[model samples]
Target: MLRESPYPMVSVSEATALIMAHVQPLRSEEIDALTALGRVLASDVVSPEDIPDVPKSAMDGYALRAADGLAPRRIVGELTAGGTATVAIAPGEATRIMTGAPMPIGADAMIPVELTEERDGMLYIQRELKPGDYVHSVGQDVRRGQMVLAAGTALGAAEIGLLATLGITRIAAYRQPRVAVLATGDEVVEPGSERPGGAVRDSNRYALMAAIREAGCIPISLGIARDDIDVQRQAILQGLDQADVLITSGGVSMGTRDLIKPLLAELGTVHFGRIAFKPGKPTTFATIGDKLVFGLPGYPVSSLVSFEVFVRPALRALQGDATPFRPQIEVTLAEPVRPSPDRPEYQRIIVRYQEGRLLAVTTGSQSSSRLLSLRGANGLLLVPAGETTYPAGSTLPALLTGQLLL
Candidate 1:
């Protein structure tokens, strides 16, 4: 259960500030080197030793003493990679060394073995040998005591390969936030289950599960809860007790069946509900004890948007993510859009590149229950709730959901 009220009703910014003011910094966890791709490193990892640790040959060549190799050369010995030096080069002789073979003692340079000719136990140098020619110097690719991987760098294929080169077997990363989801509604039933006369298939929970995974969090599903307050309370409390965050769809409104708000008041104080947004107007969030509870509307689109705005950021913060919000860009509408004076709208839109400019076309219908409207949409066009009848081709600001310019 939460403590006393921090303040009165706040705008989105104030509410977010008051809510996130005291969230503890994320902690690091363990990750095997192989499974560390796409995870941020928890600490700086230096190269344990100089890469390639030895001055080796880069080509099939002959190792010889530089001062004695002014002219021709005689074959003295052969050195394969991993083989010890059995014979050393004298003044006029050279050793046939394979690629990656260690430079032998007293050998100051390497010449391509093919460049030498021999007759009657004498070696002929077909080409001039320069000091340090064809020899891979020690630590050319990477040096010892170098800070190869900085802390907080997101590991990629190249980073992983570099770590492997340094013999890093494992690393520390931030533990993924554990999220639990519950769907509550007397009219809700599992998808593919027989929907009784008044029941609707449970799609929001599945959508939320997918979204949670995409956001890089672990989703622990607690299944569905019915309309009864006692059942919903028990399920919510149980979820909060086990998960770092609890998300539920439905029962957050003021309807007779709505129970999430009252339960939140009984447990912890409600942070805020009913933000100034369309389709997702019923969005509600609270801190149930220490677990964040997000009450999403039962409608598919509304629930998805609520998760996008609230739970996604909280999960990112819990994971030590530097930037939790999606990218937004300004665009001109291809056609006019009339917006409600009451709630801001994130209208689904299709974007296209025209003459080096991005143009957006709104999809059919703005109803919160329409799922197909968002299928091919690249991003949402945010229209302010205070405006109406935006003119076609006007420079009304639109939020590009795909990227963050910064």
Candidate 2:
């Protein structure tokens, strides 16, 4: 049996703004650069020293003066990588240098070994050489005192390699948030457990945990709490104590047994009780002290969609990520579809490139309980509330959730 709720619903934008208004970035922590992948940089990283501080050879060739081009020169010395030139080269003199080797003094250019032939300790050039040819000048890659990475930048493989090149083994990065997941309702049972009549498997907890991990946050499971107010209260208090954010499923709706919203009011300030969004209308947000709490719907799809629309961005913001929202792109609908009558809907769709055009096809059945609707879905097509139907070839903006198919 459903019951009426006294809380007023807020628009999606209003709810998002309200949630972000309270979010604060976590403090920075010193971590090894090798382990900083996917972590947000806390401060700008400046190059302490120029990359390739000294002029080096860019190829395995003979280093010689360009003025002596096409002139048979005697090989004065051979320099390998990490080896320094002990002697300077004069006119009619050359040094056999390997790739990445420091250029010999007075040597202004390099001629590839393939382009020349060596005989009787003399090197002959097949092609004309010019000054600065095949030579990596000082600070060619990066200059000293230059900003290499800006604050709030997410570290990736290339960033880590750059850090190593700059001799930065340690870095200051924003700490990843720890999220606590709590499953409620007496009808929920653990997976792989024998279910009695009227019992359903607890997929929401596992799904939410996976989503939390995918967002680069730690997930702590608080097990299950029955509809009992006391049990739910204790679990919620424990979650708030152990995690930076608390997520509870199955107790935010307008029902007689929906005690999470009321308990959140007693424990903290409920910023917004509901949102005017489909698949997650009963979503709730609150703040208890410094910790955040999100009450999501019980359905599997609703739980995941709510996480994508709200919790994910909050997690990214807590890590100081500059762009906390998903990338949005314009997509053309491949087929006609009816829009929701009231609140806006985020329809899951599979996006692909066909004939040089990006087209989207809706997944069958947008029901909140059907988790399969999200399978193979790469974008969420935003359908506005209207009585008219959207015809085929209608263009709309969609939030990209994954890579597009070719």
Full-model lDDT, candidate 2: 0.93
- Tens digits of per-residue lDDT, candidate 2, 228-296, equal 999999999999999999999998887789999999999999999888898899999999998999999
User: In model 2, where do residues sit more than 4 Å from their true spots?
Assistant: 1-3
Model 1 regions more than 4 Å off: 1-19, 55-141, 329-341, 349-363, 385-406
Q: Which ten residues in a row have the lowest lDDT in candidate 2?
A: 1-10
Cα RMSD (Å) between model 1 and the true structure? 5.7
How big is the positional error of residue 387 in model 1, measured in Å on the Cα after superposition? 3.4
Among all windows of ten consecutive residues in candidate 1, which has the lowest summed lDDT?
2-11
Q: Candidate 1 lDDT, tens digit per residue, 253-365?
A: 76778898889889987878766666776677888667788889998988886676656767766776666666666777789888878766778887776766678888888
What's every prediction's RMSD, in angstroms?
5.7, 1.8
**Clash totals for all candidate models:** 8, 0
